[model samples]
Target: MEKDILEVERKHLSNVIKECDEKHLLEVEDKFKLTYTYDAVGMGENRIPYEDVKRLSQSKALLEYSEREQKEILNHLKAYEFVKNEAKSTKVFDEEKLKDIHEILVEGIFQGGCYRNVNINIFGAAHQPPDHIKVYDRMAKFFRNLEQFKGNPLEKATYAHASIAKIHPFVDANGRLAKLVLNYFLIKEDFLPISIPLESRETYIAKLEKFKIEKDLTPLTNFFKDLLIKRYEEVLKELDI
Candidate 1:
């Protein structure tokens, strides 16, 4: 029943988007980029303020933020830019593209685009990531299944997000990378990107862990679908539809 309701809402939103003029669509896109960028970065450990995110997004400098905060915010902005500009043109979803996003998000902080050579653990998570040696092979299969996945865009996007979290392909920024990959799939499929607010971090992590440990995607899929519906509602309100 809820799934049916989401399907109805999704179609209604899709139709509205189709009727939206170029300027209106651009306005919605711009708002989503700024808002989602702020939310995504805020979900991380650094927790940059919304004002700082706005300033940095516009290329304005803020002296109050530490070097790490400044770099993290800028990296998120750059990564979001990559998604906005390149998602549509991306013909294939593969390791290269995934690594590209990770690289942008960790340019100054870490070895961008490189897999971890040492094994790692997710703090407080019930699921331990695969061994470092298995990351490459697991990631290869992950990409293969992602490309061949026959589920609807929402399901596929959730899978893309959760699988990355499960595999923990990189040493850092895995959560952000997973969310970015989720948006990349959604945007490529002509869906609006969904943002998980910092407030929802606990529930989000729980749902992710459910998927990781139980291999059940229902909870995570429902979580993502609800967020997508909220995004569609926001865009519609912006358009006065």
Candidate 2:
């Protein structure tokens, strides 16, 4: 029974990652704006976005619902809609465009879409920092890398994921947000979005922790490659090839 449960969880995680990556690639490749989804998820309850919650509510597995071309197009539009509204609604990022982008994703309606001063550990389990100021500075630095940093989307995504985990930003929900930011870069690059499956969370955190302290991304890279292959398979199947 334990083996069965583990196997089922693994399968579900792979599918979720595949669907997410493919759909995000669609957004990037087509140049569709999905900043709203980002802002919503990141900014909302400062937790997971509403759409994700809705997705989960609708289906136990968010990625189980495959997106065809038409639905895929609409999905981009939906994400963009939330992004634009959130952008217009607040100044979370202190930059109009970035705010729009973050709002749609991190802070949407279903969760806690638009509030501030909330705090908690967001990565590798939740441990309160010794000094909040030190933690805040680290968080700020991570975002700075996103702005002043240079690299390809995959490079940026990988780096951002590592940095966020290193900083361990947010009082809570950093893991989810880290991936959202990673997806933001991936979608921006027209590449598939990548995520750590729930089943792989432990391994993901272990590897991410190593990257955080030692700045080694080789293990994470291997993990991402596996996710990419799964996404490619999903896309191929959708085309009925």
lDDT per model vs. reference: 0.85, 0.49
lDDT of 1 by residue, 77-109 (tens): 789889767788946877888899999999878
Whole-structure CA lDDT of model 1:
0.85
TM-score of each: 0.91, 0.53
Off by over 4 Å in 2: 1-130
Q: How big is the positional error of residue 91 in model 2, measured in Å on the Cα after superposition?
A: 14
Q: Whose lDDT is greatest here?
A: 1
Worst 10 residues of 2 by lDDT: 67-76
Candidate 2: tens digits of C-alpha lDDT, residues 107-212: 4322322223445444334333334557656666656767676765566678876675565444434444455556655555445554355456567767776676
